[model samples]
Structure formats: C-alpha cells, structure tokens
Target: MRHVVAAVAGLIFALGLGISGMTDPGKVIGFLDVGGAWEPALAFVMGGAVVVYALAYRLIVRRPRPVVEVKFSLPTAKKVTTSLVVGSALFGIGWGLGGYCPGPALTSVVSGSWEVGLFVVTMLAGMGLHQVWERLSARGSAAAAPAPAAPLAEGPLKGVDA
Candidate 1:
C-alpha cells in the first residue's frame, strides 16, 4: 500500500516536472544564468511550488501521523553543520554545471537525452563514491577510538571487603 502510494506520488511529481518544463536542461540553464539572457519563468514556477509546499507542509504536519506512514519523517538536525554546508555547496555546483538536479534528471531520463543519461550515471557514481568515503571514514574513526582500560589484576580488595 505504501509502495503504491509512493509510486503514484512519484508519477505525479514526474508529470509535474515535465509539464512545468523543469525536465529541460536548457530551461534550467537559462534560469541559472544570471547575467546573459536570464530566464525568469522558472522562478515563478519555483515560487508557486514553494507556496504550495509551505501550505501543504503546515496542513500535513498538523496530523499526528502521515496518511501512509506511522510517523512523519522530519529532519531532527537544527544546527548547520560543516557536512550540511559542504553538501549544499556541492549540490549547487552540480546543479549549476549539469543544469539538472536529481529529480528533474531522473524525470528526463525517458526523454532519451544523452546528456541526461550521462548526468544520471555520474550522479549514481558520485553517490557510490560518497558511500565508500563514509564507510572508510567510519572505519578510520573506529580504529582511532581509544580502547577501554583493562581491569587491574585481582588485588587485596578482591579477597577482603572494602
């Protein structure tokens, strides 16, 4: 049931992206271009999306649990950490360079665009690399962690009350 809901939601989202021209790399690039022939149409689309999301979020969060899920999945982190900053920066850079973020890129895959296909491939590779890097870092941190102190050999207190 959850899977069906997820699939339906994804289908709707993909249709929205396609209908809004968000799946077009050229349109995205044009929107990102601030100096030369900047296209502002996407801005309106984004603003509308934000407004809808804000309202929907408020309404949905008022419920104790989501319609499909037992609990609403929300971000618990409040402080802006270095990882967040770095990840956001990287995402911005990738979006600017490739002119296609993950959502639109995935939606556009059916269009049979080589650029979109390449972007998806590289994005997957980057995700895999990140997983490998995190695993290696976790192992390194675990190895660097201090070991627990060994107990002292049986002392006089062992045979006598303190």
Candidate 2:
C-alpha cells in the first residue's frame, strides 16, 4: 500500500517538475542567470513549495510523532558547522553549473541525455565519497570517547530500570 502511494506521489511530483519546465536545463539556467535572460517562472514554483512546506512544517513540528513513524527523528544540530557551509556551496555550484539538482536530474533522466547521465553518476559518486569520509571521521572521534557512563538516573522514567 505504501509503495503504491509513494509511486503515485512520485509520479505527481515528476509531472509537476515536467510541467514547470524543470526537466529542461535551459529553463533552470535561465532562472539562475538573474541579470541575463532571467526567467522568473520557476521562482513561482519554488515559492509555492516554500509556502506549502512552511504550513506543513508548522503543523508537523507540533506533533509528538508523525503518523507513519514511532517518533520524530528531526535534526538536533543547531550550529552552522564548516561542513554545512561547504556542502551548501557545493550544492549551489552544481545547480548553477549543470542546471539540474537532484530532483530535476532524476526526472530528466528519462530523456536519455548523456550529460544528465554523467551528472547523476558524479552526484552518486560524490555522495558515496561523503559517506566514506563521514565514517572515517566518526571512527577517529569515537576512538577518543571515554568509557560509557551509567544509565540515566533521571528522566521520564527516573529510577526505573529498563
């Protein structure tokens, strides 16, 4: 049931991308061009998405758990770290250079363009490299961790053994 629903939702999303000309590199690049041959059409699509997400996020964050999850696993990180800044810059550079971020890149794949294929391949490689780097970094940090302390003495179940 979930798979079917997911497929339907993905189809709808892909259709939206196609209809909005997101699958076309020209359209995307035009939007980014700004001072030169700028197209503001995609901005409306993005604006609509932002509005929808803002409303949905406001409602969802109030809930203790999501309908399909045991608990909310939201990001707890609050600080703007170096990795975040570098990753964001890379993302923006890729989007500007290729005119196809991940979503549009995947949607554009059906067109059988070799350039898009190459972009997706490199994107996957970049993700894999990041995963490897993260694991290595974590291992180095975890190696320096002190021995585990005793379990919590105070919480929702204070003094209660689990």
Candidate 3:
C-alpha cells in the first residue's frame, strides 16, 4: 500500500539523517559557524544529497508518470518578486540562527532541545501569518477589482452559427 511505502521511506530517511549526524544541532551549528571550530562534514553530506537528487530526478523524468500519481505537479511560477526575496531571507535567517531547518529541526526534536522546540513554534507561526496575509490580500484585491465585459469577437467564425 502507498501508506506502507511512504512510512518505510520516511523511516529510511530518518535513519539516514541519524547516521549522517544531521540530527545533531551542534554538528549543524558547527558547520554554519565557518570561522571557529567549523566542521566540514556537513559539506560532504550536502554533496551526497546533491548527487542523489540529480540521479533520482533524471530517473523520475524518464518515467511517463510517478507510480502513485497521474502526472508530476511542478511549480509553474518563475517570477522573482518581493515575496520570494523576503521569504528566502527569513528562511535563511531562521536556519542560520537555529542551525536547523524543518527536516533537521524535526529530527533534533527527539534530543529534547528547547531551541528546536522554539524554532518549530516560530516556524508554525510564520506559516500561519503567511496564510492570513494571503487571505486578506486576496479579499482586498477582489474588492478593488472591476468586473469585465464580454469581448466582441471578430473574423469569419465570429458571427457564424454554432
């Protein structure tokens, strides 16, 4: 079943994170430090991940569709806007300060670290705030916008009977 496969894959991923020392906040923080007592092991971990992802993406693209989906749902947005810049800046700031992104943060939660807990709480709050902002912006835009009239078509087929 899909659930079984997903669970097994998640367990494997968690094990990988554990074995790679990615679940340790100290290790991650050391890597980020870059000046004092810097650890370079995280670079190796990142390299391995990049290699795996490159190979996996190539293999997946060769397939007509994924095993569990009719088609791949890829992001269509390509614009570089204010939202993207601000979001990325916030994410970088959080990662730099906490030494843990979502994946590693969740994994390190098992260590009973208060920093990880606080990071997760703030992360959740940020997500909630973004949702609220999005809803309010949409409502404001809708209220300010005017309805469009039907277009008058031209050409040979325009006035032809259906």
Per-residue CA lDDT of candidate 2, range 1-162, in tens? 657777988999899888888888889999999989889889998888899989999999899886666786665545666766888899899899999988888988888989999999999998899767766755665566543221121122221221
Better of 1 and 3 by lDDT: 1
Q: What is the lDDT of candidate 3?
A: 0.73
**Residue ranges of candidate 1 with Cα displaced over 4 Å:** 146-162
Candidate 2 local lDDT, residue 23: 88
lDDT of 1 by residue, 24-58 (tens): 88899999999999998998878989999999999
lDDT of each: 0.79, 0.78, 0.73
lDDT of 2: 0.78
Best by TM-score: 1
Q: Estimate each model's TM-score.
A: 0.85, 0.78, 0.78
Ten contiguous residues with the weakest lDDT in model 3: 148-157
Using lDDT as the measure, what is the rank order of every candidate, best first? Answer: 1, 2, 3
Question: Which residue pairs clash within candidate 1?
Answer: none
| CA displacement after TM-score superposition, residue 6 of candidate 3 (Å) | 2.5
Clash count list over all predictions:
0, 0, 0
Top lDDT model: 1
